[model samples]
Target chain A: MKSNTYKEYIAPVVVLVCICLVVTAALALVYGVTDPIIKKNSKATADKTRTELLKDADSFTEYKGKLVVEQPGAVYVKDVYVANNKAGFVATCVTKSFGGALTMMVGVDKEGKVTGVKVTNHADTPGLGTKDFEAGYLSQYKGIGELKATNVKDDGQIKFITGASVSGSAVHYGVYAALHQYKDMGGVK
Target chain B: MGKQSRLRILLNGLIKENPVLVLVLGTCPTLAVTTSVENGVGMGVSAMAVLVCSNIVISLLRNVIPDKVRIPCYIVVIAGFVTIVQLLLQAYVPALYASLGLFIPLIVVNCIILGRAEMFANKNTIFDSALDGIGMGLGFTFALFLMGSMRELLGNGTWLGIHVFDKFIPGMGIFNLAPGGFFSYAVIMAAVTYFAAKKGAK
Candidate 1:
């Protein structure tokens, strides 16, 4: 009678253990299969962003987490793109936002003038903050030299989109930080 | 377990026992990810797949499982299916995966999955449990889609990224913010409750 009870208890335990093992093995298999694809997709997105931000530049290099153009005597412009006769580098700034993160790729020439600013990613209030990306607003950053974070009335100012104060500040700070990085890398503005 | 009653099992999820509106289960994904129709649909479908498969498996093994260890066993089964859904989404529908983010992994903890396991799967036969799973999944999907549409329309003036009211309406971008999410959910719940009450008055 004791053996019968023991068998009854041990049988269920064995079955449960077996089930747990099988389920875990299946999960491992699925994770293994998808891991490669996820890595590839992430790389693709990064490459695309690099291409867009580095347009018109011959070659690009990553130095200290910033993409630097392979141009000679590149000057860093604060919120500006500086280009000479030959080649130039642009500063792309990224910042964390409400939803995800925001990336602004600012193209600078050898002359320390702003070529353009493109918003790469933004999860801001869809309509309001997203308007910051629209050409009408973003275009204002073009050809700007020595851009800085200040109110609209302040010097080296960029227009802030109405109802998107946080995003506006984030973009401003991103640009300023990128410019600082460029200056540290011997690019003058 | 009755063959004739299987239909009622499925129908219960759609109306009287709706997971989102009636039962108020799985509100995290329902509220957090329903900012857009595409995300809402993707999450809903993924959850449905996990729910149906897990429910069927649990029901089939119900008699074999000891009463003491039933909760842990149910969780393992549910987590197994959730992992499958998460991997599939990451591989085939990467965009959805990016949008859903951590919520995909959080599915393992979603109360709806556990609640269904305890309430229906533990007691019911496999067929009835499967039908219940499908019904509840659909109900959840319906609620998500409804909320997503409302939020997207007001926030971005679009549906599934397509401009719906470009000429006439000015999109209230605040609707896309977190506050907008809460407002939309409350309004939707109120409307659903109002209609449910009217129907019951008869």
Candidate 2:
């Protein structure tokens, strides 16, 4: 009776072990096949965004060490990326919005003008705050002449999306920071 | 299980016992991935593939697993399948994989896979369990596609990457935002529930 019980239990254990081994091998095979594709796609996405912000640049290189760019009335830069010939720089900036942290990439021309801005990530309230990033509103930054945080009435002054004050301010701060970084790099006018 | 009765069991999961709507078993993916039709379909198909494959393996091994360690053993089995699905999505369907994001990994925790493993697969014949899995998976996919279509249409004025209502409507972009998802989901859920209740009443 004891021998029979042992044999019965051992049989199931062997079967279980075999099944697990096979399943693991299969998963490993699939993972091996797909890992490279995922990595490639991620790189492509980053490159696309970088290109959109620095259209005139031939190449871009990440600036190492701590570099802060600040115009007289703008925010500070968290990091900087210099494009070819110092024509412009991309800076990372963050601000508090209604939903959560709003992060944006701000591009500034050599003359300290706002060249472009892209909201890289944000948790802002979707409909109200998110619209601030819509092409119509964001495109206004294309030729913004200079970084002036307090000149709210200037035609080139940052415009707030009526209902999304927090999100608007976040983008405003981000752009301001980028302008400051550009000037500090001696690339701003 | 009777041969004919086995078919009934399979059909029952497709509609009467749907993992998404009827059973409300996998709400996380249902809510998270249904933002667009493409994403919803991608996630649905990936999950179905994993579920069906796992169910087959689980059923075949049921007799071998000791009851005490069955739950843990089942989890390992399910996780293995989930990873395989994740990798496949990442490779061949990069766009869909990006849209699905972490949700693909979250499939490991989806109750539908584990629930079927515990309830249907463990005790059933291999063929029957496989059918049950396919049926339930299809039901979940159908639900996701319906939700995705509504959200995409209302949120972005587009469907399946095509701008269908663009010519007919101006300023129809409100639906593409986040609040639109909530409103659309509520309306669709209410409608499905009402029809389901009405059918039951008859």
Candidate 2 docks at the CAPRI level of acceptable
Question: Which runs of model 2 end up more than 4 angstroms from their true locations?
Answer: A1-41, A65-80, A91-106, A117-180, B1-10, B33-39, B149-202
Superposition error at A21 for model 1 (Å): 4.3
Candidate 1 chain B weakest ten by summed lDDT: B97-106
lDDT of 1 by residue, A1-189 (tens): 897776578766876787899899998999899889977875576556545654665555444444433222222222323333325565556565555566667666555566566775555533355556666777776666665443332434776755566666666655555555556556632
lDDT leader: 2
Model 1: lDDT of residue B98: 58
Among these predictions, the greatest TM-score belongs to 1
Task: Give the per-residue lDDT of model 1 (tens digit) for B1-202.
Answer: 5666788887888767789888889987777777788878877777787888989999999888877678888888888887788778778887766565445665787788899999999898788888988999888888889989999898778899898995688878767666887898889888888888999999
Two-chain complex of model 1, DockQ on C-alpha atoms against the true structure: 0.26
lDDT of 2 at A21: 90
Q: Rate the local accuracy (lDDT) of all candidates.
A: 0.70, 0.72
Model 2 achieves a DockQ score of: 0.26
Residue B74 miss distance in model 2 (angstroms): 3.4
Local lDDT at B109 for model 1: 73
